[model samples]
Target: MKQQQVKLISLVMVAVFAISLVLAACAVPATAPSAPAGGEAASTDVAAPEAAAPAADSNFKPVWYAPAPHPYFEEVRKGVEAFEAETGIKVEKQIGPDWNQDSQNQRMEALAAQGFNAFSVYPADAVGTNGLYEQLTPNGIHIINFGTSTAQPTTASFAVATDVKAAAMRAAEELIAAMGGKGNIINVLEVLEDPNTALRKQGIDEVVAKYPDVTIIQEVADIKSVEEAVQKVGDALSANIDKVDGIIATGYTPSVAIAQVLSEYKEKGGDRTIHAVGIDTDEMVMQAIKDGVMDGTIVQNPYGHGYLSMLLLQYLSEGYTPKADAYFVDAGFAFATQENLETYNNDILAVTEQIKSELLDKYLEK
Candidate 1:
C-alpha cells in the first residue's frame, strides 16, 4: 500500500508539471504585441513575423508585368507596391525589352513553368495575348489585364482599365472646349497594334463628328517611342502650323511628345495658342498645363489598375469567382487641368477606395 501511494504521488506530480508547462506555452507574453485590429498587418520596412501574415494559400504566387518601360507603368507599380504592403503578398514584377507579343510569351511562359499561378499583365497585342491566356487559364492560372483588355472572347478573368472609348471622348470634349468650340485638331495616336488604340480612335472620331465647328484636319498614328512621337508630331504641327487650332493626344507617348514639342514651339516664338489636351499626368504634361502651353489631360487611374487587379487575384485565390458580366472593370479616370493638377491624384485614389469597397459586393461571387 505504501509503495502504491508513493507511485501515485509521483504520477500526480508529473501531471501537474506537464499542465504547468502547457499553460506557460499557451500564455501570451507581456512584451508580445497584439496584432492590429481588423486583421490588417502593420506595414513596416522590416520583415513581419511569420504568424502575422494572414492565411493565404501557399500557392498564390502572383506577378505584375509590363511590356516595356514607361512613366505610366512606373505609376502603376506604385499601386502594386501598396497592395504588397497591405496584404503581405509578394508579387514578381517584370518589364520586357520591347512591346512584342513573342517576347511576352517567352518570358511569361518561363514564369508559369516556375510555378507562378497568377499574373497581372498589360497585353502587348490584344488578339495575340488571348492565345497566351488560353494556354495558361486551362492549367489553373489566373490572369488579369491591368492597363488594357485583350480582344473580346478572351480567357483573361478580368480587365482593370479605364474605358478607352469614354476616356477618348472626354479628351475630345476637353480639347474642343479649350479650342473655344471651333477649331482644327491634329489627332495623335500611339501604337496601331494596341486594341485600345482602335477604340480610342473610334471614340475621338465619334466625338469630333458631333460638332460641326470642330474638324480633325491632320492625324498622325503608329507612334512607338517618345522620339518617334516628337518627330511625327513636330512634322504634323509644322505642316498645319497656320490652320491647326488645337492638338489632342489620347495616348501616353504622344501626350508626352505634345508637351515637349509644344513647349519648344512656344520658346521659339510661335504665336498660335494651339490649344491642347492629352492623357496621363507626366511631369512634362503637368508643367505644360501650368505654363499655359497645353490645356489639360485625361488622367487614367494607373494606380487602381495595379491595386485592383491584384486585389481581384487575391480574392480569386481565396475561392471567390467573378460574377457574370464582370469581366471589364472600368477603374475610372479624371480630367486634370492646371486647377487640379497638384491634387488630382487624390481623386484617383478615392476612386480606388470606392472600387475596393465594392469589389466583394459588385464584382465577385464566392
Candidate 2:
C-alpha cells in the first residue's frame, strides 16, 4: 500500500511539469524579440541632415565722376537718382570744382580708395585719363567715358555723347538761311584747341564754304568769362559794324555774353539788320530769342546725356560689349527763335517729364 501511494505522487508531479513547458512555448511571440527591462536595440540606418538653401546675389554700387560743376551736372544727378530709385543700386556722384585735371584725379583716387567697383567719368583732359584707366583697370574696375573721348578707349567699357559736329553744322545752316545765304558772318568761338570747339568750327566752316557769297569776318578765342566774351564781341562789332551781317556764338558762356551785348545794342538804336545764332540755352539766350534779338540758338539735350549715361552703365554691368564705333545718342534740338520759342519751351519740359517717367518705370520697378 505504501509503494502504490509513492507512485501516484510521482505521476502527478510529472504531469504538472509537462503542462508548464507547453504554456511557456505558447506565451513566446513571433513578430517581437524578447527585451530586457528598460532597454532598446540600436538602429543600423540613420538619415542625413537637410541641405542648406543658397545665398542671394550681392548688390553692385557704381560711382560717377564729373569734370566740373555746371547745369549739366544737375541733369546728370537727376538721371542717376532715377536709376537708383528703380534698380535698388546706388550711384555716388562727385563733381570737380572746374575742368582741372589735378582736382579730378584727386577725386578719382579718393573714390577708388573707398572700394568703388565702377566709375562713369567726364574726364577733364582726354590724354590725362589714360593713366587713370591703367590704374583702375588692373583692379577689376570698369569705366564709362562720357562727354569726351580719350586717346585710349580700350581702357573703358563704352562711351555715349552728343553729335557735336552735326549740331554745329545745323547751327551754321540756320545762320546761313537767316542771312539769305550770302553775307559776312563772325564766329565767337570758345577755346579752339578743345575737341568740341574744333568740331563746331569745322561745321561752320563747311556750311559757310557752301555759300560762295558768305565769308567769315573774324574768329575770336579765350572769351570764356562773360565779361571777357562781351568785351571781345563788342570790339569785333565796333570794328566790323558794316561787314558783320550775322554772328554765331559757339558756347554757353559766349552765347550769353553775345546775347547781352546784342540786346543792349538793339535797345540803343542799333540796326536790327544783324542776325545772330547762339549755342547753349541760357536764360539770356532764351529771352533774346523771345524778343527777336537772336534768330536761333543750338540747344544741347543735357538731360538726355545724363539719362543715357546711366543706361549705358547698366548695360555694361550686365556683361554687354559695345561695337567698335562710339555710341552717339541724338538728343534732338529745336532751333529756338521768336517763331518757335514758346513751342520749344513746352517741348523741353515735356521731354524731361517723359525721361523721368521712363526712368521710373524701367529702372526703378525692380
Candidate 3:
C-alpha cells in the first residue's frame, strides 16, 4: 500500500511541473528588431515647420542716357549709385558725345530691346529728341528729361530743372549788386536754339530792364569753340572797353571762355576791371572764382538733379504716382565766390559721400 501512494504523488508532481512550463512560455513577450546604428527613427509626432523662402527679383532695369560727355554724367552716376544702394536695383548709363543724336537714338532703341523699363535723358535738342521719347513711351518705358524741355509735352514723366530762369536772374542780380547796380555788360550765351539759354537770356533781360544804366552792349550766340568764344568776347570787350564794366556768361563752356579772355585782357593793363558772373559749376569756373578772376558764379547742383531723377523713377516703378506739385524738385543753386568756394566744395563732397553711405546701408546685407 505505501509503494502505490508514493507512485501516485510522483505522477501528480510531474503533471504540475509540465503545466508550469507551458504557462511560462505563454507569458514571454515578443521583441521588435532594432534600428540600424546612426539611422533616424520613424516618429508619429508632428514635424517642425519649414523656413521661409527669399524674395524674387523685380527684373526691372533703369537706364540713363545723357546727350554729352560732361560733368553731368558724373553727377548722374552718383545719383544712380544712391538709388541702387537704397533699392537694390541696378542702373545702366550711356553717355553719348555732344550732339550725337543718331548714336543716342540708336543706343536708346537697343537698350529698350534689352528690357530697360525706365530712362532719364538730357536732350541735345528739343525738336530732334522728341522722336526718341515717342519710341520709348510705346514700349511702356518711363522717360525723364533733365537740363532741357521737350517740344510735345506727354503724360510721361519730366523734371523742369531748378528754375534756370531764376538761376540766371539771381546771377544777374548779384552781378548788378557787385558793380554798384550800374554797368554796361556783355552777355555770352550758349547755342541760341537751346531752351536753357533762352530762359537765361530772359532772366538777364528782366534784370537789365530794371536798371536803365545797366545796358547789355552785346549778345553772342552759337559760339561752339573756346577759341571762337575768346575771340568774340575779346572783340566785344575791346570795342566797349570804356563802357563795359561787367560780363555775364549764361552757360559753362562760354563762361570759361569769357574768363580766359578777361584774364588775358586784365594782364594787358586793360582799364575795365570786368566784374564777371557766370552759370554752372565747371572746374574751370570754380578755379576762376577762387583766383578772383571771376567775381562770382551761380552754382547749380547737377549732381542733385541726377540723384533726384533716379529717385523719382524708382518711386514711379513702385506704383506711386507723383502729385503735380511733387513733379518738380527745385535743387537750388548758390552763388559761389572766393569766400564761398571752400564751403561749397566741402558741402558737395560730403553730400556725395553721404548719398553713397546711405545707399550701401539700405540695399546691401551685412
Candidate 4:
C-alpha cells in the first residue's frame, strides 16, 4: 500500500509538470508574427521604413521655357523661383539656343516625351508656335504664354502678358508728350517676325496720327541684336540729328539699345535733346532715366509673367479650368519715368497681387 501511494504521488507530479509545459507553449506574445505566403516564416528583421510621402504638386510636371537668354527672362525666373518655393514644386526651366520655332519645337517635343505635362513658353514666333501647341495640347499638355501670346485661335490655355498694343500706345503718347506733342520721330522696331511688333507699330502709328505734326520721318526695324540697333539708330540719328525730336523703342532689345546709344550720345557732348521712350526696364535703361538720357520706359511685370503662368498651370493640373473668355490675362504694365523710377516696382507688384487675388474668381473655374 505504501509503494502504491508513492507511485501515485510521482504520477501526479509528472502530470503537473506536463500541464506547466502546455501552458508555457500557449503563452505566446499577444502579437504573433503573420506568416508570409506559402507558409514561409515571417521575417525576423525589422521591416523597412515606408517610402516617404510624395511632394506637394508632384503630379504636375511643369516646364518654364525661354526662347533665349535675356534680362527679362532672368527677372521672370525670379517669379518662377518664388512659385517653386511657395508650392514646393520644381519647374524644369529651359533656355533655347536661339529664338526660333524650330528650336522650340524640338526641345519641347523632347520635354513632352519625358513626361512634362505643362509649359510656360515665350513664343519664338507668334504664329508658328501655335503649330507646336496643336501637337502638344492633343496629348493632354497644358500651355500658358508667359511673355507674349501666340497668334489668335491658339491652343494655349492663357496668355499672361502685357497688352502689347496698349503699352505701345502709352509709350508713344509718353514720347509725344516729351516732344511737346509735335516733332519728327524715329521709330525703331525689333524683329519683324515677332507678332508683337505689328501691334506696337500700329499703336505708335495711331498715336502719331492723332498728332499730325508728329510725323514718323524714318522707320528702322529688323533689329535682331542691340549691336544692330545701335548701328541703325546711330545712322538714323546722324542723318536726322538736327530735325528728329523724339525716338521710340517698343521692343526689349531696341529699348536697351536706345538707352545705351543715348547715354553715349550725351557723354560725347551731342547737345541735341533727343527725347526717347522705350519698353522694358533694363538696368542700363533705368540708369539712363536717372541720368536724364532716356525720358522713360514702359515696365512690364516679368515677375508676374513667371508667377502667374505657373500658378495657372498648377491650377489646371489640379482640375481647375480657365473661365470663359479668360484666355488673355493682362499682367499689366507701368510707365517708369524718373519721377517714379524708384517706386515703380511697387506699382507692378501691386498689380501682381491684385491679379493673384482674382485668379480663382476672375481667371479660373473648377
Better of 1 and 3 by lDDT: 1
Per-residue lDDT of model 3, residues 1-366, tens digit only: 699999999999999998898885775431122321110111101121122212213855788778775654555555555555555667888877667678778888888998998887777667778888887887678877765666656544766356788989999998998899897888888777677788889999999999988999888878877788778887888788888888999877788787788777767777657899987665566667766788888766555556656655665565555554344445556677878665654444344344334432232222
Compared with the true structure, what per-residue lDDT tens digits does model 1 show for residues 1-366?
699999999999999999999996886642234421110111212221122223567789999999986656766777788778777789999989888999999999999999999999999888999999999999999999998888899989999999989999999999998888898999999999777788899999999999999999998999988999999999999999999999999998899999999999999999988999998766688779999999889888877898889888988888889999999889999888878765666677778778888888899997
Name model 2 segments beyond 4 Å from true: 1-59, 152-154, 326-332, 345-366
CA-lDDT, candidates in order: 0.85, 0.69, 0.68, 0.84
lDDT of 3 at 331: 54
Model 4 poorest ten-residue lDDT run = 36-45
Candidate 2, residue 324: how far the Cα is off, in Å: 2.6
* Each model's total of backbone clashes: 0, 2, 0, 0
Best by TM-score: 1
Q: Cα lDDT for residue 236, model 1? A: 100
Q: Which scores better on TM-score, 3 or 4?
A: 4
What lDDT tens digits, residue by residue, belong to model 4 across residues 1-366?
A: 699999999999999999998996786532243321110111112121122212457679999999986656766777787777677798999989888789999999999999999999999988999999999999989999998898899999999999999999999999999999898999999988777889999999999999988999999999987899889988988889999999999998888888888899999999988999988766677788889998998988877899889988988998889898999999999898889865677677778888887888898888
Query: Cα RMSD for candidate 2?
Result: 33.2
What is the model-wide C-alpha lDDT for candidate 1?
A: 0.85
